[model samples]
Target chain A: MSSQIFSPGLQQALDLVGIFVFALSGGLLAVRKNMDIFGICVLAEATALGGGVMRDLVIGATPVAAFSDLGYFSTPLAAGLVVFFLHPQVERINTAVQTLDAAGLGLFCVAGTIKAHDYGLGFVPSVALGMLTAAGGGVVRDLLALEPPALLRWDREIYAVPALVGSTVVAALIAGNRLTPLNAGAAALSAFAIRMLALRYGWRAPRAWHRNDSRTSEE
Target chain B: MSSQIFSPGLQQALDLVGIFVFALSGGLLAVRKNMDIFGICVLAEATALGGGVMRDLVIGATPVAAFSDLGYFSTPLAAGLVVFFLHPQVERINTAVQTLDAAGLGLFCVAGTIKAHDYGLGFVPSVALGMLTAAGGGVVRDLLALEPPALLRWDREIYAVPALVGSTVVAALIAGNRLTPLNAGAAALSAFAIRMLALRYGWRAPRAWHRNDSRTSEE
Candidate 1:
């Protein structure tokens, strides 16, 4: 329950890194949608902080950290501005962005699980909250862009699965009284590796209904 | 700060009524979109409880009421099921549904303002949260349907204005030490009337730019 495992400075740094990468993703989506500068900023902020805000709210931490900390609020705006002028350059580094995004996902899932457990949630809810904290921002971003959420698409590279794996590992470690900063880092690294591997291998979750099954139903 | 202003029975009844109407709207949207039964239920639940859950989380009420109360969870599913089977009849009563939706918006806005105040938020945030409570579910519903949020569109019948008015009324009453159950009911009624009037009159809020304005920008 103690928030002392990761020092305040380390936590803040991790949070900022996650927020920055997520904001970049959101800004790219906004550009693809042909939205204006204001729209880009809005989406960027939502993608960066929406998940964390949701997590904080559910766990009774309010006046959310985003509102309390000026840096958290401005970081996304800065990201948006950076993308506004340098989108062409940013697009060239898509692979780099994806790598950083994987890191963000790993960090958010582990941190969210820890926060949920600290708030006294049970194991299952903690894991669910962790996934939400990792993937909820992208969901919000896609929704705003009027696209199906990438999280729910069976065809996409495994997204929530990695977050789930990391969260479960963190939860199991806590339950076994083996949780330490080193082990938590390892948990995040595992998620990062899983996500990167999935992308590299074009791994996807299975679809519920096969094309031939639907054709047979039609007949 | 006490949650006792509205009796538990009365609050529960009001909440159920609001949820049912919101869920019906969500179900109707799902039907229009040709989503399956599971999708209908998911959208219905999101439309009915998303706003309240958001408000509750931001105000530090953990484990949100929707998660704790079985009735809150089930009511939306019931509405979705009803709509799945009887959407033709439900669509026929579109006017009636809109009337009830206005009522839901009114009730939610007032209650949200009161709760935010109790949670020690400032006046502006309380009112903002109230508007979010009134309109947030519908926004989520539209986003899930891959449409622009109704609140942000200039063409819609002034949806958020009534909610803002009602929340402000309740907040001012509380600040004046004249808040009573009777007065709160009157506040909600005021919102309901305003919304209905706007619909009836085909009233629209003015947009900052016209279609020609964009053409002028090209010059």
Candidate 2:
């Protein structure tokens, strides 16, 4: 039985590119947090692979692809090393990284959704896992850095929304028996475009209804 | 192919207890952070099952036991509800909760190690997964709360150490063909005692060689 939505070589190439960009974001965060070299590498690896690792585990893919593939392991370390030496230059090109991050988000969400479908997950949970696969690494990185998860923060530009949209699009195609490389590419690109637009526009999720509602309700 | 190390009945009970206590900790943190009811529930679930889910995914245990079991899904919600209503009283019993948390840590590490071994992970990674299983929930909790991971904080009591010791003990037994309920119980209890003692004594992990060393190294 065919186990993947895309050809193995194409998927591997997409996966590596996504891992590299996400790792850069993570490594930059570690630099901002003033962590040591080891900490930078840890954050990089976590950001690059944490979501995919999470998705694999939930779907029962044994040993995780990261654990099995030396490329998955080494890519993040390489990103971290680059960030360690040239964070100032990296910081100057922040827009480029955000755009790359958007592309990575697109690739991850579509890939995650397809993988979940292959594992027989239902629509809702599959979509959720797809977004998790796209966004979970940043959550892990932010947590390690003692910062609010950017995915959940209302102040941040819309992140998970694009991933969710891409996942939904793919899921809909799958349910309609129209899934194909062309459709998958369009779905991922849609997510990437939306995320890049959100970044460019400085879009934010709505905040709580009341500024103190969370605290007042408890009291 | 047997997938579990403990009897089904015993495992269910132990798992439930661990989930309940960990969920309580997560819920309390949410309340402290002034999160809404939904946030409390989210944190509770994350803290209770995050680690095991992570371990299961790594080992290719599909559907994660939590997703398959309604009880696992409901228990954490119940814990969150209780914390929501009785956070004041819950905070008053902080010491009791800490002790229970220690017990949960002990149970989780041993259980995680055995499960990893069952999944054919080598010794070192199995033990690491065991520690992750024991502490991953709290790390998730702290991250959700926008705080540093408790496990990584040098000022915090030595948390991973006890879990590591317990996992190592169990792994050693498994390797030596001496694993049994009695031996497992002893190993878990030994971990529990060590964690409890560390809590009571305010034990801390050693800080870096120099406070400015990390920053200086980068420059």
Candidate 3:
């Protein structure tokens, strides 16, 4: 399995970091919603592992990594505990959290595309799955929290675009027989840079054409 | 594949019916949310097929039944179209829709359990997957539409209970070596009856132990 992507140690370590950051986001959302501890844990787990589980399921990987790997399961619980005890402090470190989140998004998109490619998918579908693997967890968190999905909302920064870029970069690397760790790191970095730039500048997707007219004409 | 549970014809026909019904509910929700035709189709597909895909993934089934079968892929689009053109007339027949929804729930729970069991899972996990199969789509629909999931809310008349009952009934039938079509039908009928009665009597799950006090204390 490690040979399919990164070495075992490298893959596991990065995955754990990504899962931890995503779980923190979910736990914070639960706090804002005034949910109980159980809700907080559930939301954290969903946000941390939901996207990976979704990709595994789509690719027919049984017992998904979230369930089979103990670290993956426990990291979110630990994150939830941290949030429950020290949310105000956690809230103050927003910049740090966003930085970690961008890294996670970049890693997930590149890794997800490679995995899907390994599973015999074409490049186009692999790139699509890569975006899903990055953004899906946030979507799951918002859905469970009864909030609009940030990826689909106009107010949010361009989330999917960064993932798409990272995935496309991976796909190009694979096609060119240049999928070394160094190149992959650069691809991930590009994604991270794009996301940070989007966040810094308040970049957002445009709403549909004739948005108000569509609603009014129907009424 | 047919031998996994129902006869091929019976399975296909019943599955199509369930997919169509679930899609109708999803499409109606998208329409209510004032989504465009594309959104309506996406919601319909997710609501109809999301649960089964989740189950298939957990159970290690690849190319899932939804993607493998053309009928499964197209039925939701057809339902979305129906809702788009005839929602007012469909809305008028609330009782009919409710009855179909109950039937779909019943069918899904039983079939999902048997499929999981056939995949070599224990009864406990199979039953859980069964409930996931039946109720998971609606959960997806609500989550995507940004509504509080009805199954998890106390105000809703016990959605998961019916699915649990149906799956448990199937599990018991399997244990007793009486899992024929007739027995499975009876099991489904029991779930349908419970749901219809629950709707009539307004049964609800209890809230957490502390409830408002828990929140107030924290605040």
Candidate 4:
């Protein structure tokens, strides 16, 4: 079951890459906030691991990933060190961080959906958990940074939508018993494509009507 | 079962107070961050409801508190209004805020543990969930404010520890079938006393060796 659920080598590689990219973004935010080195490391670790930890606990998985995996714990620390030494270089390549962040989102969403399915949830719940898995870290990051959640903002480019799409595709594949490498590939591609398209087009969820009407009511 | 857990009137009152206090803190933080009224309201709702929402989902309780009760949703809005108009007065009484926050912590810890136990977890797991329930909203709040989590700080007066103590007492009571009103009173008093003592005496968790060692290594 473990072999079928995850390719250990591929999963490890993906975890490392995801951790690094997420940590980079989190570290950058810390710098913007004028936090000390320790603060930067904490933010980075939270950004990289918070969502998955939450996901694992909710699903009754014991000894969460950050606790069990040295690499997962250390990757954020390493990223924090790099940011500490290379702030100028990182600031100059901020756009690159955003791109990598998009990639991390894609990977986490797919991985999250797959993991949820492995834990024996139905399709609907699997999709919901997958969406949470993908967006949860970023949400936590935003909260710690005192920013409105990117997911809650109408101005931000699509975030949760891509995760939703990815999870739905994976759920469909699993439901059909076609959970092959190709299915996994398709899920990742769909998520990435949706995210990139949202970025390019500056797409956002429509605000509920009361959102605007109530603002005027307040004034 | 509901009657055994709480008299309907007491439950309603506690829920109202919890929502009001939680939302007030969230809204005040948003105001301090210079968010617009809508943003303040959104955050207020999130802060007041986030922990309960998470607890409900984990326990497979559908139609979470915020969704099912408009009063739950509106409590934050009311708190937002109070913060909007009474900012200076509230700021002047920061001590009161802290006291109220401690009370909230105690209530949430006990309530959360009872709910978790009701959902069929063993003693230890129930205590863990109770701590999470008490601390999770604040963690979320700090994260949004882009501040390092207060709970993770080395010098934050005892916060999570009090919740842990509270949860332990409650779990012990429930497990031993000694969950009488008197026991409940004792648990709440103990929690409140420990938290207040921590505040008064500036009690802190003993710093792990790794904390100082890590700082030295970084230096």
Candidate 5:
């Protein structure tokens, strides 16, 4: 895979946008948790960069872009500031925010797959990493705030599935050597559309087949 | 710091021991949660390797040791099997389990600092990484199981502080050019002792100063 498959500038701009959108979710969660500004910023940064940092680390990308680039570091802080001043207003329009979040997830998963592949990861690992890059931030945010991650719960509306599909599509494109800007965009759009549909229709995953509750069995 | 601080064989042995102990905690938690054997194994692996993986990633260590080495991957599964069948006995001895956990924390923190420093991080970051190395797995475990991280809540017992101290001691020893194995052992022991004392005394952190409940304000 080429090291710079897409224009670096365009990719970076897309990354910053994804970071900003993810940061908003983190900041909103912090406000909901009644955390102060410092906690809000911390959560925002974690949410925005957690997955990318994790991906970079696994692939041995040194200094991790989160620390090496000032823009990556500051984008979350900007989101935090925005949330701090206008949470009520932001909270009121959560559906719009969630719609944007689906878009962010789509872009992140596709980008994550491409980058992981560029770093020499195999098809399976790249697809897995793409989903992680899309959902990892929310895991960090929920962990910090003591909320159960929606990604892991069977009862929650399907979230990670779309990200997985997006990543898998990107990986497939990479495998076929037919990866182009238009194809990549279509892959991301497909993922975004799936997420939006899941949201619209309230689709949810089922529990393990006949999952038995033995809560009382443990003393 | 030299690339190899201690004998590689000895360091690897110590790491396996720590991994096993951490895996025990993860497995036990899964049992308590009433998860199946597979859940036990998954949690065990996550808790055992999560911290070291995080440290390695930040330091640009490619192919992270946890995935590169078979022993690193398997020790946790061994722990999971032990917990799966013996949880009843293990839960009966919670205090002893916690003692082992403290010991594991001490060793991991020191090792984390040493490795991070060897990888060219400065004292402050090395110490910070050390603490993360000690606590990161527990955080991952709790997040996966939908529990609040004890490290974050002021109401919980002082767990991370001891790990921080252990890492700091290691960093100071490294900075002072006196990082013999004996001194490293002492650093680890000191951290272990502090954690044990905290547990024995039921020590807990205080809430924010003059913090008034403003929960109703949000609604």
Candidate 6:
């Protein structure tokens, strides 16, 4: 595949937006960790692009996107700049960051699925890669922040499940030869709505049997 | 295609040995991070099996080995127990730890390549996965420890390169219908020797021009 196809202007725009939100999330986590600016930026970059880079390499794409595209590499840098200069103001708007992050989760799920499909992966693998691409960065971010993985933590809202749903819808649509812009929009909407509902209603997966055993016995 | 083939008694033995060394390295890193017992165990498990788990999932192997094998999962717990009680004694044998770590790297590279080949990947991708399986865990460990990744640091020895060489040799032998226990032994020895030499001699790749222009230089 031509790098040009991967660099369509619209995709670039979406990637930059995703990076900004991802970096903001990372910065917020770093603040919770009381990290310096360097830590914040490193975490931000890892959160924004770590998944995509891993996906690209696994699919045998040479010169991973993070290394090949200056714009892609610099998106987190811009976000880091914002965090460095406006952290105090940013801290007051955590809700807005969460909303944008939800949007990023939706966008990345679609983009990652498409990328995996382009590499000729089967639908199941594409959906799996999509979820990984959407959630892998957050996993790294939380690990670096020394928090339990957000996907594994009891307090996390519906995150990976929504991304999985979105990717599944997209994969099914693509397989059916109905992957038009409208279908993509619907898939993204489904993911965004699920995440928003989870946030607003505090939706969460039921913990496995073992998870509660320790807590209930402690109490 | 048989899970039994992959989970053979010999593979289990190799995995146990690799996990022990990897867990030791991870525990050492946790000591540097000042983590508690739980944190040390978490890091140790992540370090010992994270790379292999990643390689398996990428290759579409379900029920990741680390999760499926009670012995594999318990290895890190055993290591954690040792660290909790014998950290001072372990700390005094830094050289021994390094040697064991080299052995683990060799085992991981071979096992990763063999698994990837079983999944029907081409030679190049198998080699790449092997290198990733050898190095990816330590990269995650360093990220969690808030240290520069050993693979990315300027002080890098022949860490990835040795894995690449070993995996390539294994793949080539398999392709040529010359693979045997002796060939496997030769490949592992080659990888371990190169890694030890690099460690002793401080070998590293040349940086690309302008590579240090990024934030990594600030370190």
Interface alpha-carbon RMSD, every candidate: 7.9, 6.2, 6.3, 9.6, 6.1, 11.4
- Give the C-alpha miss distance for residue A195 in model 2, angstroms: 1.9
Q: Kindly report the docking quality category of candidate 4.
A: incorrect
Instruction: For candidate 6, give the DockQ.
Output: 0.04
Judged by DockQ cut-offs, the docking class of candidate 5 is incorrect
| Highest lDDT against the true fold, candidate | 2
Which 10-residue span in candidate 1 chain B carries the lowest summed lDDT?
A: B210-219
Among all windows of 10 consecutive residues in model 1 chain A, the one with the lowest summed lDDT is A210-219
Per-residue C-alpha lDDT of model 6 across residues A1-219, encoded as one tens digit per residue = 432223377767877898889988886666555454545666777799878877886676544566445576667867866776677677779889888888899888988888898888999999998898899999988776656788877677879888999999999988998787667868877988899999999999876665656456331
Chain B TM for prediction 2: 0.94
Go through the candidates in order and give each one's DockQ.
Answer: 0.13, 0.16, 0.14, 0.08, 0.15, 0.04
- DockQ, prediction 1: 0.13
What TM-score goes with each of the models?
Answer: 0.61, 0.62, 0.61, 0.59, 0.62, 0.57
Model 2 misplacement above 4 A: A1-4, A211-219, B1-45, B51-60, B67-139, B146-219
Q: Model 4 reproduces what portion of true contacts?
A: 0.08
Candidate 4 residue runs with Cα over 4 Å from true position: A1-6, A213-219, B1-49, B52-219
Worst-scoring 10-residue span by lDDT in model 2 chain B:
B210-219
Ranking by lDDT: 2, 1, 5, 3, 6, 4
Per-residue lDDT over B1-219 for candidate 4, one digit per residue giving the tens place of the 0 to 100 score: 231356767766776787788787887776665555544655676678777777766776543445455576668778877776775676578778777777777777888888888888899988988887777877776666555777888778988888888899999989888887567757766787888899999998876665567445321
* CAPRI tier for the interface of model 2: incorrect
Chain A TM-scores of all predicted models: 0.94, 0.94, 0.94, 0.92, 0.94, 0.91
Can you write out model 1's per-residue Cα lDDT over A1-219, one digit (the tens) per residue? 554357778978988998999999999999999999999999999999999888877777778778898999999999999899999999899999999999999999998888888888767667767887898899889888977777655457888779989999998998998989988989989999999999999987643221223222210
Give me the runs in candidate 1 sitting further than 4 Å from their true place. Answer: A2-53, A61-114, A121-128, A141-146, A152-219, B30-46, B53-93, B121-128, B144-146, B206-219
RMSD of each: 7.1, 7.2, 7.2, 9.5, 7.2, 10.4
Instruction: Report the C-alpha displacement of residue B179, candidate 6, in angstroms.
Output: 1.2
Task: Write model 1 residue lDDT over B75-100, tens digit each, in one string.
Answer: 99899888878877887899999999
lDDT of 5 by residue, B38-85 (tens): 999999999999998888878888688899999999999999999998
How accurate locally is residue B193 in candidate 6, as Cα lDDT from 0 to 100? 89
RMSD of 4: 9.5
Q: How many backbone clashes does candidate 4 have?
A: 11
